[model samples]
Target: MLIGYARVSTLEQREDLQVDALKAAGCDRWYVDHASGAKASRPELDRMFEVLRPGDVVVVWKLDRLGRSVQHLVDVMVRLQGMGVGFRSLTEQMDTTTPGGVLVFNVFAAMAQFERDLIRERTNAGLKAARARGRVGGRRRKLGSSDEAMIRQLYDSGSVTVQEIAGRFGVSRGTIYRTIARTSKG
Candidate 1:
């Protein structure tokens, strides 16, 4: 049996294209989910994996729809293979049932991981260069050190609640709470 999986990032997005394509590809049953590719907890995907059996084929519109991380995709594919289930991605034209397809997928996965590593390297280099030039990182603090000290003192005195301190300082309660937490931890 061929089972299809379709996903969109948000509930507002439509799954029409993926659904139509999966149906056209002769999917016997399909599951759809409105979940982000970066998110690990996808109920539909979990259910599909649970129900998959030997001789079953799992299909998706694209490799990205199944997972964002190459390691994650490889792990999922390995699990499916262990269960004697075939996996296919329509857009990438990858099918794990065939030797050639498995090779192609492995190459693609390597490239994806390499690309991410390159991006991280470049980002770190840029940050290091910026730091050497005396360029400070991150958002400029909305509240200065003096303001933060005052907020902390108010909280320590137990005279003002976090919300009250935040209101007085014109900051969010989270900001006030985080400031207090940071000081306490340090």
Candidate 2:
């Protein structure tokens, strides 16, 4: 079964072009969504997925109409392939049910993975350089060295409850406990 999916960015925009293309391409049934490509929620798209069978092919007027980005497209393709379903982009003339389309989709998946790996490598390198310069990556310390003395004094006196000390210090009881432990260690 050939199932079509068409989308327009807004409710005001008509899906005439995509709808016509899908019909001409011999789509058995179609779904349309008045939602932005970047949106994760598309009710009609979700419905289409529920009705899809093993041999059903999902057809879109263009590749962009189906995904927010190349990576997103690759992810959707991977999911479809896993379900034993195929994908077709009319504008791109790509059909995953065909040999050439399979080759092209594989290349796309590879490229997306390569791009993600490169991004991860660059981020790691940047963090390493920052660490070498004595910069840290985590959240800033809530308590300073100067506060340790007063915290210890209050804790040793045992007049203030741990919860009260935490409230005064604007931190969690865990922070108060850690503070007392560190001071005791010193």
Candidate 3:
């Protein structure tokens, strides 16, 4: 059985093109997901996996329709293989059932991993450089020095409770405690 999977980034986008292609490729059943590929939870995709049986070939109009990233695609392929199922991408002309197709897919997966590693290395290097330049990366402080001083004075004077101060400043009690800790540290 050739089971098809079609996807679109949003509900507004049409899956007609992908569905038509899958039909042309002789898919007997279909699973359609109308959500962003970046989303981790895809109900339709999950359902498709549940219905997959041994000797079934999972077909997609394009490789991207099946996975958001190379690692994800490779993982899915490995899972299908483990279950004695096959994978095919119409646009990429890939069929895991064949030796040459398997070789090409492995090469592509390796390249994708390499690319991801390069990106991670570059990002870490860039972040380190920025830190060296005294450019710390994180959210900006919500409370200022004066606010901290006032909080301390109110707490020390015993005129206001922690919850009262937090409510006045529209911040959580944890934020107030953190502010005190930060002020004490400095």
**Tens-digit lDDT track of model 2 for 1-186:** 999999999989999999999999999899999999998768998898889889999999999999998899998899899889999999999999999999999999999999999999999999999999999999987999888789999999989999999999999999999899988945
lDDT, model 1: 0.89
Tell me which of candidates 1 and 3 scores higher on TM-score: 3
Q: Cα deviation of 141 in candidate 3 (Å)?
A: 1.6
Q: Tens-digit lDDT track for model 3 on 1-186?
A: 999999999889999999999999999999999988987679999999999999999999999988888888888888898899999999989999999889987897798889899999999999999999999999998889899999988777788999999999999999999888877735
Worst 10 residues of 2 by lDDT: 177-186
lDDT of 2: 0.93
Model 2, residue 147: C-alpha shift (Å): 4.5
**What are the runs in model 1 whose C-alpha is more than 4 Å off?**
6-26, 32-46, 61-84, 90-92, 152-158, 172-186
Q: Report, for every candidate in turn, its global Cα lDDT versus the true structure.
A: 0.89, 0.93, 0.91
lDDT of 3 at 76: 86
lDDT of 1 by residue, 1-186 (tens): 999999999999999999999999999999998998998879999999999999999999998899868877887887888899999999988988899888986786788788889999999999999999999999988988888888889999998788899899899999998888877745
- Alpha-carbon RMSD, each predicted model: 4.8, 2.7, 2.9
Candidate 2 versus truth, CA RMSD in Å, comes to 2.7
